[model samples]
Target: MAAASGDNPSKLFAMPAIVADRRDDGSILIRSTTPLKASARCVGDWLEHWARQAPDRIFLGERASIETPWSTVSYRDARGIVRRAASWILAKGLSTERPLVILSDNGIDHALLALAAQHVGVPSAAISPAYSLMSKDFDKLKSMIALLDPGAIYVASTKPFAAALAAIAPLHRATIVSGNPDDADALSFRTIAATPESSEVATAFAAVTPETIAKFLFTSGSTGTPKAVINTQLMLTSSQQAKAQTWTFLEQAGEELIILDWLPWSHTFGANHNFNLVLRNGGTLYVDGGKPAPGLFATSLANLRSVVPTVYFNVPRGFDMLIAALRTDDELRRKFFEGTKFAFYAGAALPQNLWDALEELSLQTVGRRLPMVSAWGSTETSPLATDCHFLAKRSGNIGVPIPGTELKLVPSGDKLEVRVRGPNVTPGYWKAPDLTAAAFDDEGFYKIGDAVTFADPDRPELGLFFDGRVAEDFKLNSGTWVSVGTLRVAGIAALAPLAQDIVITGHGRDEVRFLVFPNLAACRALAGLADNADAREAIGHAAVRSAIGQGLARLKAQGGHSSGHATRALLLAEPASVDGGEITDKGYINQRAVLTRRAAAVAVLEDDGASEPIGCAG
Candidate 1:
């Protein structure tokens, strides 16, 4: 089972099997691996099963404080709390008509409340905390509140969200529920959780069917206001079942699984995928307080030192930071890789440099490279459609379609627009019938806006690589379509240690130009400066520009066409704005958002009189 930890985990990996049929109409039907049976009809069924079978097992845990010990809730205890909470919720007449709106980050209380609502046929929507706590204007928060019109709104604490709640107080008549009930308008979470379980709780639970709406997960809203993607019970259960089939190591390990997760429950990747993965498998989840941000990663490092997870999940940035830590901290390196069977990355493509660095560190610490895999899907697809179930040859290989899912690769311009049809996929968006109608095709497959290509066209089993978002790709003035995804990876690889991210801007222009967001730390290190050095000075350093020039030359030399490489580039000192939607909380860039937000930067890149632009050989 640990074979992938060192020599070759792929030997035990289920066969990389795929069946592909190409039609004369230029579409392909691709099916990979046999379908698996769903273990549960609804997400709550797993909680009930574990409560009965493994009553003493810890379901969830988190630290109360650095001075205090970790707080935990067993399956038996969780079920009791959930039942009591559900009774209180039902007493309030809260059903799917008026869903529960959550405004807190991951915690023991938050998870239980959300589960309890779903168990009793009421949908719970976990809105991103940034909308409530971080924003000063509260415009987004107001918009979300108006959309949800929830029967009750939950906040872990009142002080942080007090102002935002005040701003949106007039938007709806939701009953405010707070963990700290100091506010006069709010109900105490403890008071609600202590409600006596009534017969109505069982009746509500019995009425939940596979089609019941479990939750409403909002998209990152990179393009517009976040749309509430309706997640049904079938969607969640089917996705987990498909995951269980591919991840055979979990069952093989034969012990209760442990996870340290920081991904917000507001997002489907964390909520439906990571959260449900642990619960359905009868595993323990430690809600990580730390994030990939520089100051907060310390918390994660502390947690990792104490608790080594059997399987790890993170975005590319987290892995990037972890690789840096593992290089210097010997004890951390050992503990992180210790008994860890697999390393999973998603939210964005893992850079090849980071991928190679992790492999090298694993070789040094654990004497074998663990299977670092990724999956491709969206919130509408229940967060998983295609999974890299087998060993991939390189980065960006999103693998093949998972069991019980069929992928239709339709010809679109030069790329294949990937669409999925499966039980795991969502039926539609919440309260948006028109948008929902436009989301699927006549065959019932959801038109996921992403594109993909076979890693090896001859051998379909080799897996499929993410071709990039079909919407992000644009044409040049010369009528050549630029593959933004392919070029972005190449540009980043060429400019390693200098450019952290690049926004390709050449729509309707003669040539592609890059708005490069320099890696400030790397730039400062090369310039012999301190970590707190000014971003403009670090980016303006002659050595930094020279390194970027070399990278441009490299891209020029390896170019396939004018559209495949940038002709000029400019370093941008501005960071991606989370509020402006230029970047997501997960550190994934929104290409269209950045381009629209910084239209001036694009004009500057094309201006001949602007500061002498760095030029490539092409």
Candidate 2:
């Protein structure tokens, strides 16, 4: 078995004893022996507690541009604004039936309004801006608005969401609130926040219970329409409590927790996990306006240069982009590694090459390498079911079940399907009775549709590695199962700096093949082309194709079976479509949706006579 990282003594993570029980029916139940620490009943309690404890500490910050300084709000100021806005929300009669819906990116105003709604027992829902701004049809936004039947809708600016507003105007009767004062048809966010706090605000806050819904976080809708997963007060608080216990350094480190994040608030990883972690620990969150995309990453790099976070959080794609920047920019590498505790990654499995690159950079900049860790969960579990408290032997180890959570690993075909039951788990989907009924097992554990395997079969405490999604895995013509998650990560590593992401084909065919989305920038560099070269020209360059062929040849040499290596690959010029449900807001590719949407591309690989594909033997 591989050993854990050597930096265990430096970081004070909770070392809990893990208990696993093997059932008679070929299932395993795992839980931590440690009990969950007492957590706040509602998220509002954290805001109130911090206001009393350290009122002047900075809680949130944002910048309009790289040249401008961050506009910050302290804990005391946030509470005051939240209470006043809570009074306005109470006057508007928002409740479980009529919630507040926000359609904007991450900003200071967005965070304040969300806190205000939650302060007085009104649930808030932050919808992804892509559904409104990126999609041509606005079909997903309309469906979500109809399902919510919101009491009020909010936007940071009316100009960007004009088309979406016009599209959803016929769907609901919700009041409109705009952060921009120039919007004539909407109420001003500044005016609503200036409402005088009254006795009604305190009464509503006091009435809040653990069962009260705090937010409605939507799933990625990989298979179908996005389901509004009900996030209750218990789910939010308990997840943070377990996080605090697992990562004991949050309290023991003595330095205030700081994070510069770009993950969308519409998803659970950002809203429930990262955002709430800062709130619960009296930490400060700098709202990062940049993402991992091509044109937008410069903003993120600027933010990193400005603010050195105590704990940095990102998905694998973000890290991949960061690695490129860090390799070229010496100042960024130094600022990013200075005083950083550990790097956390989620939303997808990080390629092992990226992991090693980060470690190498950290060691080169600082004397020691930063511990890269991960966790596992979904939108339904308030996003954290398992915590990697210890540095695992390598990447993809999502540690043992957290406190107040249980992982039931039931035998499913050749894989173990992991089901979760915990206080952090959501009660059910919002207003979807049939979907809710089908989501849980007879034992009440939420079936997450993912599979796992023990890192070490004899020692349960070693943690669990994420097997591929049960729905995404498929069998070949010879009846051999193909693990898409594991193989995809390996393929990306094998085709490093060439393949951005890959979709495994040959579900029922004779051999596995790959539909690769080439990294255009990397291809351009490899081809020695100018920066303005067309994407198709870059991808079709002979040098780019030769590099892919060489990478495939390397992968073939280390293969275990036909299912393990792709014999041929077709590089796709077009990117994954957001409207087609091919990619999530967090950048996770839906394997089934990609395959379904690009059936013709898959066909090209299957056809032996196709000349577009590059063979592994080349």
Instruction: Point to the candidate with the largest lDDT.
Output: 2
Candidate 1 has what TM-score?
Answer: 0.95
Query: Worst lDDT window (10 residues) for model 2?
Result: 1-10
Each candidate's clash count: 2, 0
- In the range 1-618, model 2's lDDT, one tens digit per residue, is 112233453364877579999999999999999998878989999999989988998999999988899999999999999999999999988888899999999988899999999988899999999999999998888889999999999999898999999999998888899989888979999998899999999999999999999999998886678999999999999999999999987764322688999999999999999999999989999999899988888999999999888878999889999999999999888888876778999999889999999988887898677788899999999999999888776899999999999999999999999999999999999989999999999999999999999998889899999999998899999999999999999999999999989999988888999999888889999999987799989988999888888888888887769888889999998988888998877888889999999999988889999999998865
- Model 1: residues >4 Å from true position, as ranges? 1-4, 7-13, 64-68, 181-185, 252-254, 612-618
Q: Write down the lDDT of every candidate, Cα atoms only.
A: 0.85, 0.90
Candidate 2 residue pairs in clash (backbone atoms < 3 Å): none
**218, model 1: CA deviation in Å?**
0.7
For candidate 1, write residues 1-618 as lDDT tens digits.
355455246433566568999999899999865866755878889999989988998889899654456789999999999999999999998877789999999999999999999999999999889888766687777777788888999998888888988899898777889887676668998899899999998888988999999999988887667789999999999898888777765554323488889999999899999999898889999988888875788888888877788778999778877887888999988877766767889998887888888888888888878678899999999888988877776788998888899999999999999999998888888788999999999999899999999988889888999988999899998899998988898898788878878899898888988999878888999999998999989988888888888888888888858898888888988888767878766778889999999988888889978874666643
Best-fitting candidate, scored by TM-score: 2
